[model samples]
Target: MAAIIAADHVSKWYGQVIGLNDVTLTVPPGITGLLGPNGAGKSTFMKLVTGQLKASKGAVTVLGEPIWGNPSLYFRIGFCPEQDAFYDRMTGLEWVTALVRLNGATEAEAAAMANRALDYVDLADAAGKKIGAYSKGMRQRVKMAQALAHDPELLILDEPLGGMDPIARRKTIRLIKEWGRSGKSVLVSSHILHEIESMTSNILLVNQGRILAEGNIHQIRDLIDEHPHTVYVKADQTRALARAFLSEDDVLSMKFEDGAVIVQTARPDTFYARLTALAASGELGAIHEVTSPDDNLQAVFEYLVKS
Candidate 1:
């Protein structure tokens, strides 16, 4: 399938600072997660795709058209920016209606579209309330409402779930998934790994203004698993549990803390199998919990970067 968005050797710089460096990738139809930490060029890439900023070098295209200087393309794309840019005095409905009007909708049409969008984001009840009076989550939802009001083919959501309450976040994730199911394309950026994982398995891992890895989340997890994994085991007989793993060749090192044994293993699968056997045999006493500190995005990125 042809790409919905494509970047060819893209790089963006601000004076001496580099925002994105020689990045090339294609976002296919449906939802694709842009995963990165703060200042990792996710926003720069988003801006480039959305036509907010011209690339200092290379090219970016959306829907087979160049993004920069493309006014007509705005009608086909919806953007929810990371930064909060709002008219605090304006009511949510009024703000969204004004934005939809920019797409050349009539006043009545804009208001109707805005109302539908607000309802989608669960902000319809607060549509008449001033934006300034809304809570952080409400403000976030209002931004989302404006983005969806136009009913664009592609959605560029930059931290759309940020500042949202847990319930709101889940609802927003479900909505994005529903959009993907409806065959609309979405490129959503977020620093939180589980948030992105919840929405889509396809991801682009970015760091230091570069594309580190891009593929199915399971593939990335497999790559991360090749690195040494740190697993914490809390048990009644921690020393006995630690002793059981000491004989294993895959076990690199072990330490004890707070009634838990921290085990570093090169082969986590092997280590886990052995752990399961020991627990089942009732030789290591009662196993309270087994947790891996290296199961997060930061650890995954660190392992990937180092490798």
Candidate 2:
């Protein structure tokens, strides 16, 4: 499938400070998680696609047209910025309606569309409530409502779940996934790895203002696994688990640590499978807790830097 958004050797810089560097990528019709740290050029890439910034070099296109100086293209692209800024005096409904009207809709048409957007985010009841009075999660939903009011073809969300509570996060994730199933493209940016992982398996990993990796999380995870994974397994049979792991070919090393057996393995899934059967057979004893401190973004970052 042709990409809805395509960047060809794109680079952006603020004088000597680089924001992005030779990052090439393509986003087709589906949800894609933009994974990176605070200053990892994620926002730069999003801004480029949204036409908020002109690329310092190379080119970027959205829907077969260059995004630079293309204000008209916004009619089909909705953007929720990373920073939260709002008209506190205005009710959520009024704010959303006003923004929709900027799309050239009449007051009546804007209001109707705004109401539907509010409903989609489950903020209908609070539509008339003051923006300043809404909870953090509600405010986040309000931002989403404005983005949905005109029903754009693509959604460029920067930290869409930033202030959401657990329940609201789940609801919003479900909505994002529903958009993908409905065949609407969504480019979601977030520092929360698990949240993005929950929404989509496809991801674009950026670091030092460059594209470090982009593919299925599992594929990247497999490559990162070459760095060796340390899994802390807490169970009554710590010695037994250690002994059982000693015979495994993939096991690199094993040691006891703070009431837990720390096992280093190159093949985690296989180790997990063996552990599962051992527990079921009443051999490994009761497993209480399992934790892999480096299994998240830190591991990915470490592997990227080392490589």
Candidate 3:
């Protein structure tokens, strides 16, 4: 499949600090989440793709064409910047219409496109409301609407769900999922693991200005499975559970705590499934909780860094 975006040995630096260090990645059609914590060069990579910033070394391409200083690429690309800055004087409709018109649409066409985009984001009711009067979620939807006004083939969203209530976040996630299912190239950057997990399995993980991992999240999980995983079980009888887990060959270590038993295992799913079956058989009574202590994006990132 043809890639919608490709970065080849892309590196960016400012003085002594590196922004992106020889990172290479490809984003194909469909939803691909860029997972990273803040200051992980996610924003810098986004800027490089949008031609807002130049890389000190290497190159980035959008839709097979180089992105830097390429205004022509804007016709097929939409970007929802992470910045909170916006013009408060204009109404939501006015704001989006202006951007659409700038992309070569006629004034009447811009109005039609803006209205359609607003309706898609469920912001039609607030079309006339000034941006200053809008809440954070409303502003987010307005930003989304502006990005979609041109109906671009590739949508680059940076922190799209930031500062939204649960309901708004749910709605936005659904919209992005739908867009991905329709086969548009959508690359969304987020620090939240579950947020990205809920959207798509295709992911690019970054940490400290470098690409750490890229592929199905399950592949990364498999790699971690080779390493020992810490599992925590909270229950009324910690000692009893710890004793039971120690008998298994997969369990590398066990310890008891305040009403809980923490076990280290080389095989997490197998161990967890066995424990579940044991509970069902009345062998472990009234099991309160079972969680993978090592099953998190931070842990995964740290494990890769150490490797």
Best by lDDT: 1
CA deviation > 4 Å runs, candidate 2: 219-299
Which TM-score value belongs to model 2?
0.76
Compute the lDDT of residue 115 as modeled in candidate 2: 96
Better of 1 and 3 by lDDT: 1
| Regions more than 4 Å wrong, model 1 | 222-296
Clashes of each: 0, 0, 0
Q: Tens digit of lDDT per residue, candidate 1, span 36-142?
A: 87778999999999999999999999999998999999999999998877999999999999999999999999999999999999999999999999977788889
Cα lDDT of all candidates, in order?
0.85, 0.82, 0.82
- Candidate 2 per-residue lDDT, tens place, 1-307, comes to 9798899999999999999999888887799999886778889998999999999998999988998998899899998887778999999999999999999999999999999999999999999999999977788889998997898889989888774544566678899999888888999997645557778989998877998878786766556556566766777878878988999998998889876888888776676557656756765676655545424455668666777
lDDT of 3: 0.82
lDDT of 1 at 293: 46
